[model samples]
Target: MRGRPAALLLAALLTTPAGAATLPSASILSGTCCPGTLWTPDSRSLLFLDGPPARASTGIYSVPAGGGAVTRRFSSVAFYSPDLRWAVRPGTGDATTLERLADGRRFTLPTRGADVVWSSSEARVAYARSDTTGNFDRRTTRVFVANVFGAPRQVATVYGGGPTAWLSEQTLLMSGKASASARDRTLFALNVQTGARTTLRSALGFRSVASSPDGKRVVYTVAFDSAARNGLWLQSTAGGAPRELNAFGSYRWRDARKLLLIPLQTDGGPHVLRQYDVGTGAWTTPGDLGDQVRQGDWNVSPDGTRLSYLSARDGNVRVLRLP
Candidate 1:
C-alpha cells in the first residue's frame, strides 16, 4: 500500500494515539532464554545460539514463533547467510570457508577470519579487512567482492567505514573518509563492476544505516554533528537532499515503503511501536509492547507481518502479530 509521496514536513511522528492499547504478545521462550536470535527466512521460527547451560550443547537452536518446543536447528555453528542457504565459517587463519547447505560443497577465501556482507540474491558477497594498528578513523580497510566459488577481487579501500549494503549485484554502498586526516565521512555508492562512483552523503558518522528491500532508499542517523546535520535522516541512494525525521530511536524497515520504530522514551512507560508510511505522510501506532525490550533486541520478521523481541520484563523472547 503505497500512497502518495509523504508531506515530509511533520515535526515528529506521534507514537501514541488516543486510546492506544497494548499490543498482544506471547513469550515463545523462557528461562532468560537465548540471545542473538534471528528469524528464519520463512519467518515461522526464531534461531538462536545457545550452549550447555541453556541447551544440550553449543549449537544453533530454533523455536516456533507461536510458542512451542525448542528444536535444534544446526548442530554446528557457522555464520549462516540471511537466506539460510550458505554457511560461512572463518577458519583460525586467513581462510574463510563457504559451504552450500544443499550439497555440502565448500570453497575458501582468505578473509582473515572476517565474515562477509552478502548481496540480496546471496550469490555474491563482500568482505573487508582493516589494519589492526592505527587510529580507528584512519585505519585502512580493503574491501573485496566475490561470486560463489570464485576468486575475490579487491573492490574499494575505505578509512573508518566499510560496505553498508549492496544496492544491486554490481552497486555497493560504502562510507569512509577520503583521507586519513579528513574530519568527515563520505557515504557513497560504488559500481563494483565498472569502478564508477557516486557520492551519497558526507557526515561525521552514520548510525543505524539501513536500506529498503529494493535498495533504492536509505535511512541513517548523524549525531553530535553540526545542528543542521544532526538527526535521523532519510535519503535516496541516487543522491539528493535528505529529510530529517524528527523522531529518534531504533528503527527497522517494514517492507519497501514502511518503517517500524520503537521510540526511545524513558518515562517508565511501555515502548510504543509506531510505523511511518513513507508514501502516506502519516504515522500509525500499532500499539505498545506492554514491556521494555531487553538490550534493545528486537526485529521485524522477513514477511513484515510479525515482530519478535527479547522481553525485558520476563527475560524471554516474545512474538506479536502486526495489525
Candidate 2:
C-alpha cells in the first residue's frame, strides 16, 4: 500500500514536476473572435474588432480576462481615446470627428484621416499632414496640436516625420530630416508652448520610437543603416548620448524602469520572455510562452501584472499572469 502511494506521487511528479521553469498556464479567452486584440485601459478585458460573419454586428467586442461571453462594448467603431472618453471618427477626406462619450459633445479636426497622438493626460493631441506629391522620404509634413474640443493650429514642419509622442502636457517628441537634402533624421524634443527644441539624436532612420510612461526617456530602433548605429537604442528625451540595448527583438516598456522583450527567434520554438532593468542594467529571463506568438502580437499590461498574446498554435488570444 505504501509503495502504491509512492508510485502515485511519482506519476504526478512526472506529469507536472515541481520547480519547473515552464510558462504560466495561459487561458484561451476568445471564440472565433479574431486577432488584433487590445487590452482595455483598465486591463480588465480584451477588446477586438469583429463583424457580421462572426458576431451579431460590426463593433468593438470585449472578452473578460477569465473568459466568458463576448459582448459588444460599442455599437459603432472608431479610433477611441485611451480612456474611452472620446470616439474619433475619420471621414473619407480631411475631416475627422471627435465625439465626447460622456456628454455626446462633438467637434472636428482636419486630421486628414490620420489618428491623433494623445498626451499622457489625454487632454491635448498632436497630428500631422504630409504632402502627397513629393519624394517619400522628403515630403513636407506639418505637425499640429490642439486641446480637447478646441481648435488645432500648426506647430512645426519637418521634411518627413510627424509627432512621435507627447512628452508632457506641452512638449512633443518628433523626428525628421533638418531639410529635404539632409541625409540624417533629427529626433528632437519640442516645447510647443515655448518653441524650444532640444536635439536628442541624429540617425539615418528611427523605428518603433516609444516614450517612457513618465515621459522622461525614449527608446527606438535603428536598423539597416550603418554598423555604428544599427541597434536598439535608449536615450533621454532631455538630450543625451544614446545607449544601445544589448538584446533586440520586440520590446515594450513594462513600467518606468523595466522593459520586456521577446527575442526574435525563428527556430519554431516557444517564444521566451526576457526583461531588462534600466536602473541596474541587468537582464533576467522570466519564462517562456510555451507557444509561438503570432504576428508579434504581445503586450505587457499597463499595470505590469499580466501579458496577452495571440497563440500561433490555436489562433486564439491567450492571457498569462506575469511573474
TM values, all candidates = 0.94, 0.91
Q: What is the C-alpha RMSD of each candidate to the true structure, in Å?
A: 4.4, 9.6
lDDT, model 2, position 113: 92
**lDDT per prediction?**
0.87, 0.83
Clashing pairs in 2: none
- Any runs in candidate 1 off by more than 4 Å, and if so which? 1-17
What digit string (tens of lDDT, one per residue) describes model 1 on residues 69-90? 8889999898999999999998
> What TM-score would candidate 1 get against the native?
0.94
User: Model 2: per-residue lDDT, tens digit, 181-271?
Assistant: 9899999999999889999988889999988888899999987787678778889889878988755678888888988878776567677
How much lDDT does candidate 1 score?
0.87
Q: How accurate is candidate 2 locally (lDDT)?
A: 0.83
Please name the candidate that would achieve the greatest TM-score relative to the true structure: 1
Worst ten-residue run, lDDT, model 2?
11-20
Total clashing pairs for each candidate:
0, 0
